[model samples]
Target chain A: MQKEENKIQAVIQINDLKKSFGTNEVLRNFNLQLNEGENIVVLGKSGSGKSVLIKCIIGLIKPDSGSIKVFGEEVTDLSHDNLDKMRVKVGFLFQSNALYDSMTVRENLEFPLRRHWVQKGKENVNDLIIEALKNVGLAETIDMMPSELSGGMRKRIALARTLILKPKIILYDEPTSGLDPITGKEISRLMLDIQKKYNTSSIIISHDMNCVKITANRIILLIDGTCYASGTYDELKKSSDSKIKQFFD
Target chain B: MKSTILKDFLSETGDLTRFTMSFFREAFRPRYEFSEFLKQCYVIGNKTLPLVGITGFIMGLVITIQSHPSLKAFGAESWLPSVVSVSLVREIIPVITALICAGKIGSSIGAELGSMKVTEQIDAMEVSGTNPFKYLVVTRVFAATLILPILVVLSDAISLYGAYLGINLKQVVSFDLFTNQIFEKLTFSDVLPSIIKSYFFGFCIGIIGCFKGFYTINGTQGVGRSANSAVVTATFVVFIIDLMAAQIADIFQIT
Candidate 1:
């Protein structure tokens, strides 16, 4: 039992994280852990600090207090240069897809690689771009502007941009929020495929149950800025507790 | 209520000081974004030249036409070019050109960055291991700072040509005579102080534009507010700087 437990490693660990804006407390005593090759869905309603939680992990928002240790390094303690170095290993997909309007899909993908100084030979960079686009099934969109693409395509291109670095961990903020049912499912499927292929750990913030079922290995209910309950889909669904059962409803 | 307004004003001033300090810090840091800076320079300088040129030409023509009668009434019709050139080069053209750019470039940078902010593009850049402030704000502010003086100089040249045309319209004053008369009366002090003040105008416009946009919040409405405020604030700052420059130039002359 001890040997089996030792084999399972946590890639991200958070303890007692707190963040507030003005008089409103967004996150209070939030605690979570994402293990190796596991997908944890942080399910919550709007303005419940789901997005804030992920942003804190990426060091975009400094938590008011507490620790977020990623790969055994304290995120809050890391310098700007060190934090940027840490970001190379972690990918974040914004809720808006956040594609640069002035850049083509190819330029958008190249931006991260160029800034991170990951630029090698032209062919090598091109090959990586093509591969990343292929993964998202949008290889033909290499030269297209983001404004020309549909919402679903833009999201895929955004995911491709995130994947270009081949990060060890990905933080997805509402990946399926604005999509149609079919497109949402497709995105969920792509998330599963990327996880399986890269063997990457992820913390996905979502309210979409279908996406949760399709991608999450475990579900953590974030109620009132804290992790209220955590379990698998079936286990949480069968819970008698009203707060946990509300999610199933 | 008065205290609250005062507190808000002080807070805004404090924030702007910090933002300006951050610009200096990031500007000298390694990994200078040379390509982006060049691109901003092209955008700010090249794109603004036509508008500046048209305004300057019209201004010189009107001023020369208006002043010709006054000088002629004083039995000094030959002094037309000298008077027009002195006023345009020494004061009018620089302030006008700077104000035009404050409206044009100031609003552009503000709206662009504000839209980027509200849409999460800036945050996206941050998470991608890129410094958005260096790529966006620093490049733009520096470009505006470096480009305005060049624009003012060009505007002065174009306005002088327009003034020459205005003189030709009423009576035949040969181009050579007009040129000689203008240069004969114009001193180094007249040209130098105007050119120097233009650099200050550019810096204030750039800083205000970037500061308004960098911290934009809310949504689409917020972007609109940022762009509008950028133009207004930059215009006001340009005038204030011009007034101060005039006062300083006066002190220098007295000493």
Candidate 2:
């Protein structure tokens, strides 16, 4: 809808993106634009290539042909070092909540900072870790291994790790998957709080209708490797289109 | 079926070679993982030493006891220490130690990395702007390469001590005389080639284990397959490398 508004800047732009695995096409002519400070939930069923779309944005999967420009720099054209530098601003939360089993929660949070050789401003690494943990309300879990945490707790810890870098853009791959409804709601609310606190733009890949309703400023439905329809949740709920109605049902 | 099998074999070999070349490329570059390398060395070396020691002791004892009768029958019993020292130093102990490491360390690295790959930790590390290959693969391979040689040397010493114990069980050869007999027959040629070959064994074990684990797909079941194949492939490669080392040593007239 904002496509007509030339005033707002698009943080991420995808134009005619295409990707395929051998003969099976995963993405075809998929186009999207993520505006600054907006939360766009990419709604799709399993194997609908929602995950693949975000991966292409982050350069994890190379698209067969397309243009992905994040902050006006072409992603596929960037060299390895430049890609790594670009990733520092782009946070990706895996569906599995990929916490390192060998590390304590504090160590997991510290990994990115140390890896990027990030210099802190008047605050040491410990303080940053504490701040990140406090933001997730898991300050007590600093010393605990990932195995010691529950599924919900692990997801929160992983979110905390992502927050440590204070990324401008956070990509959530099924952020509320594999949890009870209550925990899932709690996580969805926490995601809103993070967006407000950090003012981060996000692309959330999820099928949970409740999650989509809670987090999406706009929703894009992915069908047949393309954007089938997109609108506000209530707007899509009122539509009579069978493909879009199936999702609501 | 035959063509498919051959194609699969060739594909696997091609992948492994590329993996090895990538390792070498990253290994010489800067941002080396020194702390991780030291930690891997500790895990691969200190933890596995006891197993290598016990095996070496048993091997030395059994070989000495088995060969004593043959020597005594030919009136060459006095050459027990000399003969056992040469054989143990030149071939047996090195091969056995590498095989043990291939089973223990190879399977361990394979399973550990395979699980990490399955759980998406490696992918997570990549998104965090950290090179997982440098942090995980290169450090482990280098640790295995450096540690195996030290282990082989220690096993050689322990095996000689066991040979002394085996000799003292039947005859009254003094400790000083046994030591002298071993040293007199043990030349640089005998000690050097075996040690060199152990390095190759360590390199192959480390690379093969990492290769299997890094490319693991199909979830937990794939992880199990990787660990099993890591042991089997590493064990086979150890023998092949040993055979090649023996031939090279023979051609050079080192023995």
Q: Which ten residues in a row have the lowest lDDT in candidate 2 chain A?
A: A114-123
Candidate 2 chain B weakest ten by summed lDDT: B123-132
Supply the global lDDT for candidate 1.
Answer: 0.93
What TM-score against the true chain A does chain A of each candidate get?
Answer: 0.96, 0.95
Specify the highest-DockQ model's number: 1
The CA lDDT of each predicted structure is 0.93, 0.93
Alpha-carbon lDDT of model 2 = 0.93
Lowest lDDT 10-residue stretch of candidate 1 chain B = B246-255
RMSD of each: 1.6, 1.6
How much is B34 displaced in model 2, in angstroms?
Answer: 0.7
Tell me the number of clashing residue pairs for each predicted model: 0, 0
